[model samples]
Target: MLNEEIPDVPYHVNGVEYERGYYLADGIYPTWASFVKGFSCAVDKKRSYFTRKQAGARKDIERTFGILQGRWHILQQPARGYEVNQMRRLMYTCIIIHNIIIEDIGYNLAENDWVVEPVVRMQRTWIDRCDTRKRRTKELRDSEVHEGLR
Candidate 1:
C-alpha cells in the first residue's frame, strides 16, 4: 500500500506527486508532501513519534470497514425495500455494536493511541529532513542511471 498513492512511483520523493483531486478525495492527511514527510519522520525516529503511533492505531478503523464489507455483502447491492435513512441507521448501530465487542475483548484504543503534534513548530525539521533526503537521492543513481549526473 506504500505506493498506492501513485499510478507510477519514481525513485525519489518528488516523483509521482498527486494532484489536488486525489488529495481532496482522500480526506485524511490531505497533502502528499506532508503525508510522505510524516512517515519519513517516523522512519528516521526524529519527531512525531506519538503521531505515527496514533496513525497505526487508527488502522483498526480501516480493518473495521473491511470487516463490514466482508461480513455484510448487502452494502454493495442496491436498496430493494429498505429506506436509505433506515439502512444508514442500521449500519451505524452495527458499528456501535462492533465497537462494544472490540472493547469487551480487551482492545482499548485510547491507551494505545499516540497523537503526533502538528507541524507548526516542525517546519525547520521538515526542511532539514527534506535536504537530507535530497542528498541521499544520489544512491538511486546506481539503481537506474539517469542523464542528469551532476
Candidate 2:
C-alpha cells in the first residue's frame, strides 16, 4: 500500500504537464486532482466509454490483488508489524510465486513471458523536502487539472 504522499515531480499526459500523480477512484472520493474518477451516470457516449474502461481497469486490479491475497494469506492481513523493506520483499516474493504458478498452469504464456532485466536504482537529492511538499500539495488539489482530466 502507498502512503498517499504525492511526489513533487511533473508528469505528462496527452501533451499536458501535471505536477502530481493521480489515483483511480470511485465517485465516493473527493473531487481532488489526485483522484481520477469515472462518471457515475455517464449520459454521453464518451462518458459511458470512459466509465466502462475505467471500471474494467479497476476491476482487473481488484481481481489481481484478490487472487494474490487468496494465494498468500499474509497479504490479506494488515502489514503493521512488518517494516517497509520486509513488506516489499514479502509482496515481491508472493508476486514471483504467483507468476510461477501461472506459468505452470500455462496461463497467458505468450503475453506474459518472463523477461529478466537488470534493475536500475536512481538516487534522489532533495534541497528542501518541506517546501517541495507544500508545492506538491497545492498541485495535487488543483481543481483545474482535475476538471481537465475528467
Candidate 3:
C-alpha cells in the first residue's frame, strides 16, 4: 500500500505550494517526497525540536490505533469476514461507533470550536495525468518541499 501512488492534491504550507499530500513515516521508509521522516540524530536545536514533535505526533497515532483495537477486538484478531468489502464496512462501523461514544461521553475536544468544511471534489481531466518526465519533475518539487519542511 505504501508503494502505491495516489492522485496529486495541491495544498500550501507557509505560502509554499506542495504538489501532493504527505505521510508521517519512520526512518525505515524511503526518503520519498511524500514521506516525512524525522532525523535519526539531531545535532541542532531546530532539528531536535522537529524530531521530538514528529515522534509525539506518531505516538498519538499509535495510541489511537491501540485504543481502537482494544475497543474493537475483531480488529486485533484475524478478520473473519469472507469479503474485503464486508471487512471494510465492519471497520468503518466500529470507527463510527467509537466517534459516537466519544461524542456521547462529552469527550470531543473540538465539538464547538472546529469548523467542518465541505470537501471540494476536483475534476479529473487529461492534463491531470503525468508522463514519466512530469512525474519526475513533480517528485523533485515534492522533495524540495519535504526538505524545506525539515
Candidate 4:
C-alpha cells in the first residue's frame, strides 16, 4: 500500500475483486478495520494451512506478539489492573509501539509492514495508551534476530 493507494477503492486479489483500504504508518493517518478482532472483510478460512499462510503474509500478529513478549510487563500482565478503557488504551498503545518498531526495520528482514499507527492509536485512544518505546525495542531485537540472534 503506497500513500497514493488510497481512496484506494476496490482492487483485485487473484482476479477476485474486493475493497482495498489504507493502513497508517507509525501511529498516524486514518486506517481501515478496527484494530481489534476481525480487521478484514475477507471470507474466513478455517483451514490451518490457510490461517498460517495468511498470518504469515500479514505478519502483524507475529510482530505484535514479538513486541508484547519483549516487554515483560506487557507480556506478563498486559491489562491486569486496568479499567476497560485503560485496557483498551494499553492494548493499542502497545500495538502502535509495536508497529513502529516493525516499520523501522521490517524491510531488511520481513516482507511487509503490518502495524499501522492510526489503527494502533485508534485502538489505544479508544481503549486510552502507546508502546512506541516497546515496539521500537522489538524492532531492534528483530533486527538482531535477523542477524541470527535466534
lDDT of 4 at 116: 33
Candidate 1 residue lDDT tens string, 1-150: 221222322333224332211111122443333222123334445345744654565566566766776776535555566797879786776677677778999888667754544424234576776775665443322222221110
Best by TM-score: 2
Candidate 1: residue 143 lDDT (0-100): 20
Against the hidden true structure, what lDDT does model 2 obtain?
0.73
Off by over 4 Å in 3: 1-11, 77-98, 101-142
Q: Which one is best on lDDT?
A: 2
lDDT scores of the candidates, listed in order = 0.46, 0.73, 0.70, 0.44
lDDT for predicted candidate 1 compared with the true structure: 0.46
Per residue, candidate 4 scores C-alpha lDDT tens digits across 1-150 of 222222334554345544433222222322323111222333555333444554454576666667577873574664566788887777777867765775787533245434333422233442222354454344333422221210
Q: Candidate 4: RMSD over Cα atoms?
A: 16.0
Q: Candidate 2, which segments miss by more than 4 Å at Cα?
A: 1-14, 94-127
Candidate 3 backbone overlaps, count: 0
Worst lDDT 10-window in candidate 1 = 18-27
Q: How badly does each model clash, as a count of residue pairs?
A: 1, 0, 0, 10
Q: Which model is ahead, 3 or 4, in terms of TM-score?
A: 3
User: After TM-score superposition, what is the CA distance of residue 11 in candidate 1 from its true location, in Å?
Assistant: 40
Q: Residues 12-64, candidate 2, lDDT per residue (tens digit)?
A: 87688865567888888888798888988889999899889988888876787
TM-score, cand. 1: 0.33
